[model samples]
Target chain A: MTQVIDVYDPSDPRLDDFRDLNSIDRRPDLPSGKGLVIAEGVLVVQRMLASRFEPRGFLGTDRRLGELSDDLERTEAPFYRASAEVMADVIGFHLNRGVLAAAPRPPELSISQVIEGARTIAVLEGVNDHENLGSVFRNAAGLGVDTVVFGLGCADPLYRRAVRVSMGHALLVPYAWANSWPGDIELLRDNGFRVLAMTPNPEAQTLATAMEGLARDRVAILVGAEGPGLHARTMRASDVRVRIPMARGTDSLNVATAAALAFYERARR
Target chain B: MTQVIDVYDPSDPRLDDFRDLNSIDRRPDLPSGKGLVIAEGVLVVQRMLASRFEPRGFLGTDRRLGELSDDLERTEAPFYRASAEVMADVIGFHLNRGVLAAAPRPPELSISQVIEGARTIAVLEGVNDHENLGSVFRNAAGLGVDTVVFGLGCADPLYRRAVRVSMGHALLVPYAWANSWPGDIELLRDNGFRVLAMTPNPEAQTLATAMEGLARDRVAILVGAEGPGLHARTMRASDVRVRIPMARGTDSLNVATAAALAFYERARR
Candidate 1:
């Protein structure tokens, strides 16, 4: 069982992992410097306890400590109980969630490792928005996408806001970073995955039609950022170019929403 | 046609409609107070111009003015051309979108007016988040949801953030507020809609199966707030309870994402 220690002073050195989270998260050398994955609130903290990430420490109010007691039993990490005021002072803002857990970054899984036995995957390119990145992970988890592969210019999924927005699914879902551009597309193809690149081109095949044909095949759904869609090179590398049949005059859906549609179509058994 | 008037001063009375947007929007008596709908960025501004919400005035830099020149030709609103600095001073922040449009909220459409000939509509209950409300509009417009009906506890869709997040679709799409929540659902059924309430219940019919069966009928998708889901009374009144078939262990997708899946499934033909 985890130990609960009362802490009054906001400047306690032992609570450094959970201090000035707003500033620390925005620092230029993030995920490389301290690289701590912070999970906030009762739900996310419980999810962190269940994830592969081992907690380094936890800080929260007494009520949160009680709420997290069952999940805390699985970890040896100490829970530093503090007043809500002290938490606000340390984190540089009032977090309504009341409880927070900090975990150090674990080694990332390779593309090969994450894609193993995965029948459906999402590959992202230039999806640099953190909220969208989180939503993609959340959608992937809910809609049966087995893995995610980041191609280029994608935001860090472990960013505090991303993780919180994802409701902690970023910790649960398996994802990997692609070292090569379209070259990685070949690796997925070699592994028996038919890659479908999403686009707004009206001439392209509709998502429903494409997904129906590939329902029996291992599939990879490729998505890009909202405005400037998939790079032509990446589009050319895919096995089939697909488009969501959209209403007239509207250009495209949000990147994450588009990805969710693709995932839904793939999983619509 | 829009007439450009250069104003170097940030305190011009003509620009009052665009002042301190962030603070004014949060005021308790807002929408009902100033009752102005603000549209930011070129695309959204253009959308506002095309929409029924006529632009009262425009505050923008020269670049945005030039970009909106063609669209502004139809409007008689004065374009208050200002430097980026002056624009920032007036609006209380630096808007990278460089342009802003303010329009008076027109009289809201009624349930009968908005759903006059709708084939697919989204009914939202307790969806109070502005961002999610906006995403719903964007997804609805893209996926052929003809109209939206607000049941209860939904945030104002014309709120500034909602308009921006919806890519101005909140302005473009026809939406109405239901004075009687689950009662208004009867009006939809009277108008030939088959109400489908979305739930995470494993025993509920899958969205694909439900939607496929109702493909020939008018469909109304009911979604509640993220956690509480549809109220019991609302669920009992619906024609069918449908669920997106999710991966095991995951509970739900974002509210807007769930709505989008329903819309996509309905429009999958």
Candidate 2:
């Protein structure tokens, strides 16, 4: 069972991990940084408990503690219960969610480990927007994409806003950053996965047609940044180029949305 | 030809319509609101010129003015040229978009007016989030959705954030607010549209099956708020209940993304 500590003061040293979260999350220390992974609200905290990232402690209102009590039973961490006002003073803002869980960042997973046994995966390059990254994870989870492999120029999926925007799927979904970019394409090919790059080139086959051809094979849906799209080297490295049929004069869909469409199409097969 | 008015002062009375944009957009004066529809950035400004929303004036740097000179030739509105710093001082923020165009809200189009000659439409209910609404517009534009019809509990599509998120497609794609909610659905039926309501229920026919049946017919893709889907009354009113085949243990896609998939399915035929 988890321990419950009733705390009255906002400035208590014990609450430091949960303090000024906005700044800490915005400019997270990196390169051997020991920044904590935070999950907000009852639902996400519950997910955090179930995820591989183990929480060291929790801070929440008595009501949230009650809501999370059954989940808390699975962890030995302490729940620092406090009032809404105290939480606001501690976090430097009013947190309507009323609960938070913080866990130490775990060791990064390897690309091979993430891709093992994955029949359908999403490979992302230059998707630097956090909200877009989060949405991609949420979409990947919902659409049955088995794994997410990041190439380069991607934001940290554990950023508070990414986590929040993804409805906490960033925690549940398995993902790994590539040690080497377009070179990593060889690893996927060696695993017998067809790396299909998503592009706006009209000459490219429609997503449905491409997926239909690859229905019986392992597939990787490759997506890039919003405006610049996939670098030419990465595009040439792909086994096939797929495009969502767009209306005349309209630009491509948001990268996350485009990724979702490809993921949806791949799952439909 | 459009006229050019050079202004060196940051507090020019002529710039009142574009002043303190963030605050003005946050708490929009509605109903009697003579507030203008703002188009930020050069591309959006060009779109606003082409849209029914007529700009009363323009604001931009000299560089942006040169870029937009060709598009501005069609408009009679005076281009209020100013430096980036002066533009920032007037707008209360550093808008990197570098240009803005403000147009008085045009009289709303009736449901019949927007639906005329349209083949595919999106009907939304209780989708109050501005970003979602904008994404719907952007997706609709890209996926060949012809019109958007709003049900009750929807936000203003012309809101600044919605316009920005839509990439100004909110201005290009025609949308209408229903005088009555589920009641307006009948209007669509009478217009020869096969109304297909999007639902998360596993029992609902998948989007592919439903779209296959309606390949040669006019269709309306109906969506509701994210968590609570289409109201039962509205669901009952739709001709076919359709759902994106989501993976097990997952909820629904973002309403806009769902709509895009439905639109893509429709256009694929």
Candidate 3:
């Protein structure tokens, strides 16, 4: 059973892992900093406990402790119980969710490791926004995408905001950063994955048509940043180009939204 | 041609419509308050110009003025050109978009007005989050949804954040608040529309199957809030309850994303 330690001092050294969360220089989640993966809220905390990112400790109110008492039985990590006031003073904000869990980020998976046994995967380029990255993971997890491979310019998926926005699916989804931009395209091909790049070009085949033809194949969907879509070299390297059939006079959909449509279309059967 | 007045002072009374934008109580876009509509960035401002929310005035840097000069020819609203520093003082933050447009709230359109010639519409319930509401409008605009009808517990679509997040489609896409609750669902049926409610129930028919049958009919895709979805009474009123095919152990998709899938499926033909 996990030990419960009641903490009254807002400045206790033991709470350092959960402190100054919004501080730009001191936030523990920064990859260059402590690299801690922080999970906020009850649902996300529960998800963190289930993910590979094992919890180092927990800081939450007594009410939250009782709520999580059943799940806490599985972890040996200590729980620091504090009043909401003390927690607000320690973490630099009043958290409505009433609970938090901090975990050290585990080693990242390789492209080959994440794609093993995967039938559908999402390859992202320049999705630098943490929220967008989080949404993509949530969509991928819910829509049957087995893995995620990051191309160039993607943001860190383990960032605290990303994890929180992903409803903690960022911790559960298997993902990897590609060492070689377009070169990794050949690696996926070697593994029998057909790469389809998502574009807004009206001349490109619609997503429905592209996805329908590849229903029997191991498919990889490549999505770029919202405005400056896939780089020319990356576009040329893909096996096929696909477009979402959009209404006239509108720009492309949000990158995450576009990815969700592709994932849904691929999984429709 | 629109008048361009060079202003060096940040406290000018003429710029009051664009002042203290981040102040909760003083924000000009508050419905019960100023009831003003605000559009940020050059793209959204240009969209506001083309929308029905006639601009009362604009406050932006000289660079944005040059970018918008061609679009300004259609309106007589004065553009208050100031330095970035002065504009920042007036707006309480340094807006990277470098431009802002303020317009008085126009009269509300009735359900009859928005649905007159519409073939596909989205009906929202308890979607009070401004960003989600905005995203629904953005997705609807891009997916051929002609109108939007609000059921209950919805936030003001004209809220500044909603307009910005919607890419100013809140101003372009016509929407109306239903004077009745699910009662207006009958109004839609009377006008030859089939209502489909998005739910996460496995027992519900999949979106593609439901949409395939409704392709030849006028459709109204009904979506509820994320957690506590459509009320039981509201669900009963819907013509069909449809769900997105999701992987096990996952919850429903975001309200806006689910709406997008329905809209996309309906327009896929």
Q: Could you tell me which residue pairs clash in candidate 3?
A: none
lDDT of 2 by residue, B1-269 (tens): 67999989999999987999986564356563646789999888988888999999999999999999999999999999999999999999999999999888878999999999999999999999999999999999999999999999999999888998999999999999999879999999999999999998889899899999998899999999988988999999999998888876678678888888888889888
Ranking of predictions according to DockQ:
1, 3, 2
Report the C-alpha lDDT of model 2 over A1-269, residue by residue, as the tens digit: 89999999998999887999886564345444645788998888988888998999899999999998899999998999999999999999999999999888888899899989999999999999988998998898888998999998899898888887777789988999888889999999999999999999999999989999999999999999999999999999999999999998798899999999998888887
Expressed as tens digits, the lDDT of each residue in A22-68 for candidate 1 is 85565445556745899999998988888888898999999999888
Question: Which has the greatest DockQ?
Answer: 1
- Which residue runs of candidate 2 sit more than 4 Å off their true CA positions? A26-31, B26-31
**Model 1 chain A weakest 10-residue run by lDDT:** A26-35
Decide which is better by DockQ, 1 or 3: 1
In model 2, chain B matches the true chain B with a TM-score of: 0.97
Regions more than 4 Å wrong, model 3: A24-34, B24-32
Give the alpha-carbon lDDT of every model. Answer: 0.91, 0.90, 0.91
In the range A32-85, model 3's lDDT, one tens digit per residue, is: 564588899889999998989899899999999999999999999999999999
Error of 1 at A216 (Å): 2.1
In model 1, what is the error at residue A255, expressed in angstroms? 0.7
